[model samples]
Target chain A: MTLVDTLQTSFKAVLSYRLRSLLIILAMALGVAAVVMLTALGDGARNYVINQFSSIGTNLLVVLPGRAETSGSFLGAVLGQTPRDLTLKDAQLIGRLPQVRRYAPLNVGEAELSAANRLRAVTVLGSNANLIPIRHMKLAQGSFMAQGAGSNAQIVLGAKIAKEFFPRTQAVGQRIRLGDSRFLVSGVLMSQGETMGFNTDEIVIIPIDYAQTMFNTTSLFRILIEAKSHSEIEPAKQAVLAAMKQSHDGEEDITVITQDAILSTFDRILQALTMAVAGIAAISLIVAGILVMNVMLVAVSQRTAEIGLLKAIGATSADIRRLFFAEAVLLSMAGAILGFLLGQCGSLMLRLAFPQLPAWPPAWATITGIMVALTTGVLASILPASKAAKLDAVNALGKK
Target chain B: MIRLTAITRTFHMGEQAVYALNDINLQIASGEYVSIMGPSGSGKSTLLNILGLLDKPDSGCYELDEKRVTDLSETEQAQIRREKIGFVFQSFHLVPRLTAAENIELPLTLSGIPSEQRQIRVNEALQAFELKQRAQHRPAELSGGQRQRVAIARATIMQPSVILADEPTGNLDHQIGAEVMTLLENLHHRGTTLIVVTHDRELGARAHRQIGMRDGKILTDHTDDAG
Candidate 1:
């Protein structure tokens, strides 16, 4: 028979058993939709992280005290068991490197600040004047601390802290007591939102030396570095590591990581998550295939007399096989297309709910979902179609 | 023309071999109207199946239109069946999902005939069977006589040279059965070979040749030119 004739005959057969065909189609559609929606979520997470990282300055490097080797062991690190701590002298040496454009020595602590008889506990950040350029910070009033003024009792208030502490007066040039130390506010920062899970608008910044004196520690928290250019990142990282080893008595007990490395690691992990979810969703497609096989087998037995009649009317065994195969393919194709449309709608809903996330399904996942559904459907029907073809016409026709 | 010689078909029922057709010999010329009448288990139906190529004999030499067809391949035999033979069944095995017109067009459709030509042949068959008004009705919607007429139209749509009817009126009343028999007879009068297998003696008497079978063997063969 012609291709059109074969499809038409199978279509009629599928239409005849409405409820059976619908159940199978619904199963197939659910499988494909699951793949699409899950993959979209995974990809959106990856995109969200990348966007978060991109907001910070590029060509940046972080220097944390103690080594974290690539062998996956913590070993004298992360728990502060290292023999030497990263000091301000180490930061001074790294900041002087020719490949380094800027550096910020960061020391984080928490303290109570009271002003005009209003007291509140707040996060305190200790960094240098160059921190404004390196961290992409802005000011709404006054100016940042002067360069080379590490010993001055000056502070910059985050936008939210400024609003809360000095609601009726200018924040800059105002005196506030912080952990038994009095300080003059140098500036009120612009209202920048959260970045890398930390809200910059909630912290108060002071010079690194006074912060060390107030918190009573000589060790630095970590150093943020910006290289002179994109190509200078690797050279600057090596220079900083070499200088740290020299200052710490010839011991390389520091971990130096670039921003690109962290971003790529997150990217790899999220992409693998997408694939894993797609694989789990593909199992449903296989189950749907088994359902198709089961229903087709029942149909073959039910239509034995029809098969016999076809044979008696001169249809060859190959013709019988083609008709059944065509039926399976048509059902799967219809289900796949319907599922793709449904998945698109689901993803659109997700995007509307979480406007920040880019929750669109990738092309590869969509194509593979449809192709796998079709392949499984055809494979499942092989046994039933062959059984129908092998029927003995005389016996199938029954006794007269 | 059709011929069969030394044909044997054995059936094994729980290790005991019984002959469904034993050493049968028969011949019928082209355009001949013949009938085989016998009681149940007499193997008359088995003979008709062998002649229609639906069952293979244990041993046989058969020829149709001067070609040896006993050992033809399955595909080749199907082609021969499509081009040279037609079958009308006792229960009127029309596909219930298809309309009457589609049922009659089945043979042509299976033969890869294009839609325009298939439609023409189906329309002609509907007209000839007097089923023009019931063309769009499904088998469940058609009456007994109308269903049988649709089946007969489907059987002859390929314009085969030979027609085989096995108790074609078994499921109908006397009036509908007579009408269906008359339809088959009308095809036979148009120079098409007709073979009917039945247990009704009155129906068997209408054929030009009569063969009575018993216990898988032919008991009597008679030819009457006047009938």
Candidate 2:
């Protein structure tokens, strides 16, 4: 038969047997939509993490004490191997590099800040004046600490800390006792919501020397360095390592982590995760393909008499095969078009419900969803189509 | 023209070989109307199937229109069937999903006839069969007489030289059966070769010649005047 005639015949069959056709189409569509939506979630999580890291400031480096390759510099003290202390002097030498913009030396401790009998336990962070620019922090009221370093009593309170410490009074120009020392309020930091697992608004800030005497420690918690430009992060890391080795009697005791390295590591892990979930969702598509095979086989058997009649009316076996293939393509094409719409709608609902997620269907996932469904549909059709083509006319007609 | 030489077809009915057509030699000229009548399992249908190229012989040869068609490939046989032979079944064999007009155009469509030409020919067939008013009706909606007429139209739409009817009236009432027979005979009168297989003596007697079968062999042949 002419290709157009064959196509028309197959379409008419599909329309006439609406229920069976709809079952196959629905199976395929759900499979495709699942792939799209699941991948959107996985990739969305990756993007969310990347954006969080990006907000911590670009061209950044995190320097930790001791050989982090041998110690989880995080849990080294608990593990009985003490990491060498990193001091504010090392932070100064690292800042001298032409590629380095500034470095924030951090030391964390707990303190009770009392303003008129209002005592709240708060985490106190100690850093230099450059901490404000290096960490990309802003002040809502007053200025940050004056640059000359000593055991100065100037302190900045986080927005939440200031409000909780002095409920009815102006927080700037207020005095709060830190251990045995009284400090004057220097600035009230703008409220920064939780970022990279740290809540800036919930903490108190003091100069590095004052925190050292209060906590009785010469070691720093971490040194956050911002490179002069994006391309200088690697050079800045090298300069810090060189300076640490030269100053510490040639001991290579620190681990430097660049923002690019950390970001790429996260990117790789999340990319793999997205692919794994997509693969899992694709299993449903295969099940749908098998369903197509099963339904098509049943259809061929049910239409044996029709096949026989076509043969009797001079239809070649090729014609019969083509007609069946046309039916399969028609079914899958309809399913693909419908699935695209369903997947898009599903993704839209997801984004609406989770505004922070940045959920979107990736282009590759969408293309693969439809293409894989089409490929599976064609593969599934081969067996039933061949069976129909090979049917003997007289036997198919149920005649002896 | 059709020729068969010592054509033999066999079937195994649980270990015993039964011949459906045994050593049968027959020749039919183009445009001749013939009827093959036999009791059940007498191999009348098998013989008709062999003549129509729908079945193959176990040990014999078949030549149609002076071509050695017995050993032709399945595709070749289908082409010959499309261009030269037509079939009308007792059950009508109309595709239930298709309307009367589509059913009538089936063979032409299979032969790759263009849509414009297919449309014209189908319209003519609808009018000729007095089914124009019912052209859009599916097989379920058509009367027995109308379904049979639609099948006849489909069978002849390719303009085949031979039309094979296997009890074309067997499923109809007497009046409707007579009406179908008249249609087949009218086509026969127009010079298309007609072969009808039926056990009804009345139907068999209406053909120009009759062949009787029993025990897988032709027992009698005679010239019969058209009723």
Candidate 3:
């Protein structure tokens, strides 16, 4: 028979047998949709993490007090034979290096602050004025404490803290009681949500020296260093390490980490996770393929008399094969189109539900889902089509 | 012209060979109306199947219109069947999904006839069979007589030289059976060879030539030249 004639006959057969055709189509559609939706979720998570990391300042180097080494004895660390503390003097030495553009010494503590009888416990941050630019923070009002403004009773309140402490009046010029002392609010930080892990809208910032005296400590928590350029990140890390080693009795006890390293580590992990989820979704496609085979087999048996009639009317074996094969391909093509539309709708809903995540299916996954579905459908049709083609006309006609 | 020489067909039933056709020799000319009648297990159906090219004889020399069809390959046989033979079955084997007009156009479509030509031929067949009103009806919606008429129209749409009818009216009532038989006889009058296999004596007697089959052999052959 002609190709058009074959396809028309197959289409009619599929349409007449509505329930069987719908079941197969549903199975195939679910397979394709799962692949698309799962990959979108995985890829969205990866993008969200990368977006969060890129939001922080680039070309950043961090110096932690202790060396992160597997060879270090746990017993030594437990017995307090730890590495020397990273001090503000070390931060100063690192800040002067040519590779270093700016540095912020961070010391974190928790305390209660009161203003006009309103008291609430809050996290306190100790850092220099450079912390604003190094961490990419913005100020809403007034100015931050300068570098030489050491031991002054001056503080910066976060947007949320400022609102809670001095709701009616301007917070930048007001005085607030912190710990056992009182300090003037030098600035109000902008409402920048969260960065890394800290909520910029909730914390309070003060000069590092004043925070040290108030908390009764001489050591620094961690030091954040900004490189002059992208190419200077490695040099900046090395310079900070060397400066800390010289200040701590010629020992390289501090661990230095670059932002690029941590960002790539997270990227690799999330990409792998996406691939793994895609693989899992592919298994459902295989199950759908098997379902197609089963339904086609049943169809062959169900249409035995029709096949016999066709053969008796001069349809060759190849014509019979083509008819059934066309039916399978048509079903799969329809299912794939339906599934693509369903996946797009699903992704749209996801985007609406979680606006921060970019949950669009990758082009490769879309193409692969369709291609694999077609291939599986055609492969699954082989046995049933051949069985119909090889049917004995005499016997099939004999059947009721 | 048609010729058959020493045709034999065997069926294996639990390692026992039961001959369905045994050294059967028969000949039929084009434009002849003939009927083969027999009781159950009389091999009349097997004879019709061989004549229709739906079954192959184990040892035979059969020729149709001077062509040695017995030795032809399956594809070549199919080509001959498409161009020269038509079949009407007892059940009126219409595809339930297709309309009456589409069923009549099946052979034309199979042979790659264009749509415009197919439409013309199908319309003519529907009109000729008096099924113009039921042209759009599926088989399930058509009555037994109308279904048989549709099947006859489908069989003759290709203008085949030979029409094989196996119990064509077995599923119809007595009045409808007479009507269907008249339909087949009308095609025979138009010079298409009509071969009917049935166990009904009255139906077999209606043909100009009658052959009775039993035990895989022909028991009697009678021809009335008066018609």
The backbone clash count of each candidate, in order, is 0, 0, 0
- Write the residue-wise lDDT of candidate 2 on A1-400 in tens digits: 8889999989998898899999999999999999999899988999999998888887889888866454444555445354468988888888887888888899999988787787778899998887887787889887767655345688899989888887788888898887778999988999988998899998888999889999999989889999999989888888889999998888778879898899999999999999999999899989989998999999899899899988988999999999898898889878877887898899899999999898898999999999999999999999999999999888777631
User: Each prediction's TM-score against the native?
Assistant: 0.91, 0.92, 0.91
| Model 3 docking tier (incorrect/acceptable/medium/high) | medium
lDDT (CA) for every model shown? 0.90, 0.89, 0.89
Query: TM-score: which is higher, 2 or 3?
Result: 2
Error of 1 at A211 (Å): 3.3
Interface RMSD of 1: 0.7
Task: Residues B101-143, candidate 1: write the lDDT tens digits.
Answer: 9988888888999999999989999999999999999999999
DockQ of the two-chain complex in candidate 1? 0.78
Over the stretch A1-400, how does candidate 3's per-residue lDDT look in tens digits?
A: 8898889889998999999889899888988898889889888999899888877776888887777666645333344455577788888898899999999999999889998889998899999898988888899998897556655788999999999988889998899988887899999999999866879899999889878987999998889989999999997888778777778888767889899899899999999998899889888888888888889999999889988988898888899999999999999888887787887789889999999899988888888888888889999999999999999999988876
Reference-based lDDT, residue B208, model 2 = 85
Candidate 2 docking band: medium
